[model samples]
Target: MPSRFTDEREITGVADLTPVQRDQLRAAGKLYDGEDLDAAARLVDDPDDERSFLGFCNLWRVVDGSEDRYDAWLYQVDSGTIFRAGTTDVAAEIIQFGLETRDPAVRAELGPALVEAGLLPKSDVSYPEFAGLLRTQQGA
Candidate 1:
């Protein structure tokens, strides 16, 4: 069988995959179609996974041309969840949020989150600061 994640490495065999995996694949497929009920359900079961999935969902929204909603939802995502997803955009957003308010914890948390989420190659994002780029892009 084909690998579900892009890395193409086995986290577990399909037969051994948790119900979480099966639902994730389905929700990922449904995200753009606006059928996020299952995805939302999965999130309730596991906020950690849901947070990561939401980041991917947000990315999908952006890539699929739902920019306005994406920007709006960006603020709603929990810091812990963003870190869990570890997306570069999520990291950048966190960095930007911290920069605006001068919060060290945001930057500190984002770094390890990026590493855990595989968004960054290393834990070096520990103190990464976002420029005004994201703000400008968001028209904030």
Candidate 2:
């Protein structure tokens, strides 16, 4: 069975967005308001709202042509704990980004999954270093 994250329809750009989806993306952007991921997550009052928020965050690159901003959004989502409850595609994307950016937080959150996915080896030394950083942050 296809996962909920698996959208068969391809949305190429802003022009391809539906009116409601566009509105949701705009609302989500407002909630994001200058790099605040917690604020965006707070706007999600329910599952439907969460889905809309994540969808916008995930596809913002297509609309704005900003991969770095999208990576920031993914990092924020993971930091906000939304990524823990996100779909497979969300996890996979974040893991991929983590590997690319060497983001300790993302590595800490998805280390095991990364190994399982073969993106990182089980013996990866960086996992311990990143996990230690995560522990320090949690303890702080």
Candidate 3:
């Protein structure tokens, strides 16, 4: 199965967009917002490249599209927590640790998962909790 992170994505920035390109992006963004990755890919120039594709995925997460889990991942990445929960079973334990131990490290590790899962708030969660959660989950 294709993981959320595609290997060939790129990022040329917004200035690189054209009117038609903008339209395609808008369409793709909308499709992504609607939880339709296939449809979004159709609006993009290269589905295999990282730029437009990563942008689409980022947009999807920003809009809290498709699954909340993806949003959680984005949020955590934005906050400098590079870790991802791997899969649902892995993610569940991470989240539970955050609820149980209030460990910042664990939370830091799991923060991305929360962002992907769309569970985090606008305010950045504490780093200690994230770290602890991550450690706990890792130990498990």
Candidate 4:
């Protein structure tokens, strides 16, 4: 699948970020890197900003690459600092990420959002079933 994060800017180091952006990553116990920089640029860009949705962006980036990266974003999500819901983009990203990873844990995390958005039926389906339903919804 093509990357949803399409802007391919090179981020050299933490020095390129604003102090607040640096602080947010630090507080989340995450280091600044190319992917983190990309996620930050796409998700959070201001100082002292508290947008929880960045967690999802980071999660989407790392889900298929590195477990440690995935864990860092998962921690950010569990930290409850970023709030994501009621938006088509957010819901869609979650669904796409879940489908791409095919990880039950990721699917379980996103399942409720899919159901709440009326994209999936409100039933107790297994992870694979839930993924299949999403795939069908996407016309895959």
Tens-digit lDDT track of model 1 for 31-110: 32345454334333354653334332222121113221111112223211221121212222432222122446544433
lDDT tens readout by residue for model 4, 1-140: 11121122233345565554344444433322223433344455554555323433332222222221122222332221111221111211222223233455554444533343343334434455665655654567
Screening candidate 2 with a backbone cut-off below 3 angstroms (N, C-alpha, C), the clashing residue pairs are none
Which 10 consecutive positions of candidate 1 have the poorest summed lDDT? 1-10
Count of residue pairs whose backbone atoms collide, per candidate: 0, 0, 42, 1
Q: lDDT of each structure?
A: 0.30, 0.35, 0.34, 0.34
Expressed as tens digits, the lDDT of each residue in 90-131 for candidate 2 is 222333234433455444444433333333443555566544
Assess the local accuracy of residue 105 in candidate 4 as a C-alpha lDDT between 0 and 100. Answer: 53
lDDT by residue for model 3 (89-139), tens: 212122312322245544343454344344444354444454445456456
Worst 10 residues of 3 by lDDT: 72-81
Q: TM-scores of all models? A: 0.22, 0.25, 0.25, 0.25
For the record, the alpha-carbon RMSD of candidate 3 to the native fold, in angstroms, is 12.8
lDDT of 1: 0.30
Error of 4 at 48 (Å): 31
